[model samples]
Target: MQYKTVELVIEGKTATLFLNRAESMNAMNIKMIDEITKALKEVAASSVNLLFITGKGRVFSSGGDLKTMLSSTDESMFHPVMDQIKNMIVTLYTMKAVTVSFINGAAAGLGLSLALACDYVKLEKSAKVAMNFINIGLVPDGGGHFFLKKRLGEHKAKQIIWEGKSIPANDALQLGIVDEIYEGDIEEQLTFMKTKMEARPIQAMIASKMIYSTQELQHLVETLNLETMNQLEMRNTEDHREGVAAFLEKRIPHFSGK
Candidate 1:
């Protein structure tokens, strides 16, 4: 399967998915979300033991596509986008492989949510991350609300979501969002982590991920089932189909919310 917004490369036990849209800061448009979900499904079907996600250029992701968001008028148009976002997070959280996010630069909104969904996150020293949904008039649509509340606690999570302030890589480390910080060469750090990860037995890694996800998330099954059903319902909308088609064709999607 070929993808436009994302590049997938599988080597031995490691599969790397790069957000290929540097021009847009790898923003979460409908197409990117579809490609990512497709990629995860592919990885799940393969012999890949570890899944690593990163972005091109300077920014990991800038969150939702502002152009799409601004163009949307009908409130119903928002449901499908939110459904996809939730599905992506839930799918990644329950993946049977060890997932790692390599945050090279800025990650905001749904971008931050995706990174946090991974089992491990590595950040460049200069990287910035924020839950920037409040900057606009929208609430956290993705699993940002769930992941942040779980990791940062309810009070701190509310503060971050409400403030929409960017936290640097070092600060993110202290906040437990980023597991490791790379100062010199990011590729070197990734290579080291890759080697370390590849050394583990694949079954053990998968089992560990399952255990942690089950234990950490009390409503894991219910959340994923609800998200899947909601996503299917959203797909029935004209806006959702248009958004997906426009994304695949590499053009700006015009969503009418019909």
Candidate 2:
């Protein structure tokens, strides 16, 4: 199928799903979310054993399209996009491949959440990441809470979410959010990791992934549902309005504890 927001390329036992909307810094809109879910399903049905997810341009994803959300006149348009985000994450997490998110640049908000869902993550040494929903007075959705707790546990996860800080590659590595950070020649890095995984008992690796993911599946579903519900409530708040306004106006947001 022809995909506008994402590109799926399969070669031998390897496949790549690239976030293709460089115009918006690969910001995930509803169309992009829809296409990502479809593209992931295509990969799941394929012969690929090693899967890579990255962005077309510099940024992995600037996160969710706040502009799109801001322009939304009806709340009806909002719910489906959140639903799509949930579906996309679930599909990626449980897919039958050893997945890696090669973040070549900035990954924030929903973008960071996507990376966190993957089995392994490789971030560019110069890249930065943040779970920055708080900047907009919003909660982290797209399974952010679940993934973070799996990695950082609840206390540290809560710290990152509340702080809304942009962490550098080394800092993220120390925080254990990403597996490795490579400097220059991402192609070389990709080739190396692809070869390394393929050399392993690939099916066994996939089996273990499926086993763990299946065990935690119910909790992930609950998190997604809760995120969707809370995020909807956040959108109606005065603080969220101020945050978006402050972001667009290039100023500090005065978030009332509303």
Candidate 3:
């Protein structure tokens, strides 16, 4: 498929997928999610042994499209987008290509989840990341729960998710969230890592990834479905409305238990 929101490049045994909506901070709109899903599928089915995922602009991704959120009135508006996100995340999680994510700047909410889905996650030294769904009275989707628990265990993962605070790159690395924290250009680091992986037994690496990913696939699917259901319910709450209002108006949300 022709992609507008994502750019997919295929080179010898390596593929790079860029989140292309820089003006919007590469927000995960339906088009971006669909494009990513299709691109990942193509990479998985081809000769690509390594995949690099990164954003095109200063920030990795701001999160879901807030403009879309403002116009959404019901589950119909939410379901397809959520499902597309789920598909994209699942594809990235299970793909045969050894995937790497370069977080050049901020990665929040679903963006963080996308980074965490990759086999290796690298962050620029000053970059920050957050599972910030709580800020908007929502929960993390896109297999956020699944990946976090795997990396951080249930207790730490729950604390991170519930706090919804932006974590600095060093803090995130110490917390075991990101694999590496780099000082130089993340693009340069990504290129170096890709070359390193290409020299190794890529198929052997792919086999190991397949085994672990297969074992965890069912849990990830359940998490995605649960996130979808809960997000739809959250959309119906008064607090969600308040949160969106506060965000748009640049004020703190006054969330009352209604």
Task: Count clashes in each candidate, considering only residues at least 3 apart in sequence or on different chains.
Answer: 0, 0, 0
Writing each residue's lDDT as its tens digit, candidate 2 over 115-222 gives 888889889999999999999999999999999988899999999999999999999999988888888776787788888887799999999999999999999999
Name the candidate, 2 or 3, with the larger TM-score value: 2
For residues 179-213, write the lDDT of model 3, one tens digit per residue.
99888876678789877886899999999999999
lDDT of 1 at 32: 94
lDDT of each: 0.77, 0.91, 0.89
- The pairs that clash in candidate 1 are none
Residue 76 accuracy (lDDT) in model 2: 90
In terms of TM-score, which candidate is stronger, 1 or 2? 2
Candidate 2 local Cα displacement, residue 88, angstroms: 0.2
Quality of model 1 by C-alpha lDDT: 0.77
Q: Pairs clashing in candidate 2?
A: none
Cα distance off (Å), candidate 2, residue 8: 0.8
Tell me, by lDDT, which candidate is best.
2
- In Å, residue 94's CA in model 2 sits off its true spot by 0.6
- Point out where model 1 deviates above 4 Å: 215-258
Query: At residue 38, what lDDT does model 1 achieve?
Result: 88
TM agreement with the true structure for every prediction:
0.82, 0.98, 0.97
